[model samples]
Target: MSTFFRSSLRSFATTAKSAHHNNHRDNHKFLPPTSFLGSWEAPKDPKEAEAKLAQLRRDYAKQVKELRKEYIEEMELMRLEKQRKDEARREALRVATEERKRLKAQEAEIRAQQRNIEQQQFRETLLKERAEKLEYWRRKVKMHEEKKAEKNELLRRQSSMWVDEAEIEKQILDTVIATTHF
Candidate 1:
């Protein structure tokens, strides 16, 4: 059977038994536990009764003192245990804080190094591009000079081939005279 069903069954059985017992209890008289001491004697005289009462009072006072002493000792032990636990907790927190700080410091240092490396690489790339541009400009200037020089040489050769008008006439007369002599 399910636990709930079994428990309900047991509860019902106990209720039935209690009902039967209650019926039987009509013939029996019950006393409260508080009013039932182990055994008692009635003192015949007032003096004896007074003495008995005093002894009982003293015994209860002693028992109360012993119980209070034990309670105080137990409280002291508990206080010491609590103090020790608190100290351990504080120490653990301190150690964990230090470890976190150390880890953060290491991470910061690595980040700084990474930034430095990136900066250096960027600078190197910029310098290399600038050098390449400078070399390209220098080669362009050299090529322009070579072209200028070649053009000047061609112009000089063309000027040497030209003659004045007077020189051309004299050359034609000399040619006619030479043809007549032949």
Candidate 2:
């Protein structure tokens, strides 16, 4: 049979047995109502009932003590498990935080390297521009020197023409003076 059916059959059997016992006890005429029903009463001998009640109380106390001990043990186990889980969670968070810090530092280093490269490129560009400017100035100076030399040549030719004209005039004046004297 299934477990549910078996348990129900056992419960029915126990109830039937308890009913039969009650019927037998009820048929007795000499016993008082309270004694037949197994309830508390002012017994003819009170000391025996008191002792039985005390023993039952002790048994109940022992069962309660055992239950309390089991409960405390279960609670302690749960507390330790919770603490272990908390520690693992804290360690995971710590590792994640360290990883984030490391990534940020790496990114900062990359950015710094990029800045340095840019600065170096800028310096090179500035040097190239200065070299171009100096080349332009050198070409301009060369052109000016060539023009100055050309002007000096022109002046030398003009002075030579003036000297020839003066020599011719001096010769004509000597010829006129000699003719008048003859």
Cα deviation of 150, candidate 1, in Å: 3.0
Clashes per model (N, Cα, C within 3 A): 0, 0
Task: Show model 1 residue runs off by greater than 4 Å.
Answer: 1-43, 157-182
* Tens digit of per-residue lDDT, candidate 2, span 76-149: 99999999999999999999999999999999999999999999999999999999999999999988998998
Which regions of candidate 2 are displaced past 4 Å?
A: 1-45, 157-182
lDDT of 2: 0.90
Backbone clash pairs for candidate 1 read none
Q: How accurate locally, in lDDT, is each candidate? A: 0.92, 0.90
Global fold similarity of model 2 (TM-score): 0.60
Question: In model 1, how large is the Cα lDDT of residue 126?
Answer: 97
Per-model TM values vs. the true structure? 0.61, 0.60
